[model samples]
Target: MGLEFNDETFRGDYTFRNSAKAIARFPFPFAEDSYMYSVNMEPHLPGRPGSVFEHMFDVDEHYVAEMRDRAQVLAEDPLRCQSLPHMTLAGWDLLELIMESKARDYPQWFSLTKDGNRWHWINRPLQIEQSFTFLDETTLPYGPMEYITRQTQGDFTLQDQRDDNLWIEAGMVTTQADWSLDFDIGMSFHEWHAPVPLAHEMRVFDRALKFLLNLQLGAPVRRFNWTMTVDPLLDTSPENYPKWGPSKTTMTPETIGHRQHLRVELQTLHRLPRSNAIVFPIRCYLIKFEELVTVPKWARRLHRVVRDIPDELATYKGFIRNKPLMLDYLSKYDDGAPTSPGIWPE
Candidate 1:
């Protein structure tokens, strides 16, 4: 059987529907009640014919909206996009990968052409057509990675393998789900993941890095990670703590369903062809718990996982302050009472 897990970006343009189909297809992360970190990587391939989801990558309905949001974020804080001097080649490689993917998958909106080392790109969505030489810094206004990130939903992280390990050498991350790319840059594979409780004890990261190192060009790997957020807005980095900080103490039993959301990150890791750097892309999705309980199975599983979650893991996830309220809210779903509006009747 394929992998299953429990798992938005906000652009008011996108509305999450609480339909049976959406609930049935939802990536529910917990295999058991409690949560713990693991490598959880799976082969990156295209989805089955006619399937709603894609295998390695997905250009969702929110693609354009999220890209607009990213452009705004970068415009407001340029530091959100960074790259070291040595990662120039890797940046170019990633730009090509992204541009090629966009042109291939979205022919109507994007197209790419090449004449020897010179290339031309037409982006209908952004309303631009430009020609430039590959690897020429002056061709693109910003670095390749930074320019490409403005057009893709996921924030990209490029890690270079050296001394038998992968070091985070560069990335363009404007809509950080929660973690900071600034702090994670230059950290070794193990060092960056040190804060994750179980992955280290279980040797998950060690095994994962080994798998990543051995990964070939055509084969990519994907995984899922999830958490809860108080709002639908995407910018939750430490810099915006003041805006979302009060939600922890302010959420009550009645408002929990509407105010809280289940935030899921679909992380895809690709081994770049030329530079051999690992290209990590994180796509964030959000669905309100109020919308989640439309499916009985999701509601029950989520309740059990939250109830059984250990204090340390919960605390690490910033659930310490609001766990009780969330649990109480979920318990009502388990008890078969529709606490929120627009309940799908059994």
Candidate 2:
């Protein structure tokens, strides 16, 4: 659960997964289909650290791509940026609140200021500074929010310290805008090689709060996440979904491109338990919004008698191969629960 990955990382190493019980609750705890996300770990260059970035669902690929292009463009010409276009992205309100408190409670370590909703950081006398803005939930399809993360060390030599060129895995998420009990959860290991992740990875309070933040909103956004540790209990199995929707999905590298997209979702839980400094930009898309139908009132009470609970395998705490915990949990709630015949997806 505490391992790390670089550019040469494996697919099975850093993707989202859950325990047997977790998958059994698909469309509830996990999405039934594979979420299309472009996992960009930054440019794999020498003396440069790669980062993991995701863009799920079709938000606006053109805009997301442009913001990243411009940020890198402006980095070279801070002065000339005035003549060109520069966008001030949103989503920094939470950071300003913490930075302000830090300035008062821990003045020496943290210094924060807010110009309107814009927040900046200066830990030293060097040109080392950071800034971020708050972005509201979007209902319209527009370009991605833009921001930059840089690590500059002038004559500084600290292996562990983040002292290098600025790097950003820029991206965005789309609005789901559906009327289903659907949600998205993503969890990843925050790369240990980066220092930015220390803010959340090393702090239990921050990680726990992040969990609540994504829940408040319908789906989980990766920008608020870090690198996730590969937990053995985590669900990372083959994709399975009911094919009753008008829009189906074709998942492939060429089709999904840098991003992996999936449709026909009921509910989702995209989580991030990152141990490194990374950002995952996730978006939920509901191709079709239908009636929030439920069966007879008493139908919801048929779970206990219909579903069977398997005996404890090795340790109830964890799971063994092919253990049917998912089935157990599903059965536990089938008192009169609705059942979808296996052939329905056809």
Worst-scoring 10-residue span by lDDT in model 2: 152-161
lDDT of 2 at 31: 16
Deviation in Å, model 2, residue 146 alpha carbon: 2.9
Kindly state the number of residue pairs that clash in model 1. Answer: 7
lDDT of 2 at 94: 20
Please estimate how well model 1 matches the true structure, expressed as its whole-model Cα lDDT.
0.74
Off by over 4 Å in 1: 1-26, 31-34, 48-52, 335-346
| lDDT (tens digit, per residue) of candidate 2 on 1-346 | 1222112111223233222321222122111121112221222111211111111221121222223333443354332111001112211222222334345643544466767756566543223456544342232122222222111100000011023211122222211112111111211123322223223444643453445333322233332111111121111211111211211233222322122111222112222222112233222211100110122111122122112322331122122221243224333334553444321111
Q: Compute each candidate's TM-score over C-alphas.
A: 0.86, 0.20
Error of 2 at 218 (Å): 17
| Residue-pair clashes per candidate | 7, 51
Give the per-residue lDDT digits (tens) of candidate 1, residues 1-346. 1221111235343243334444555555555545667777778677643222443445545556667777777777777788999888898988898888878866777799999889999977667788888999898888888877777777789999888899998987765666778888899999888888765778898898899888888788787788888766677777667867676788787878877888777788888888989899987766778888776756876787788888877777777788888888888878643323221222
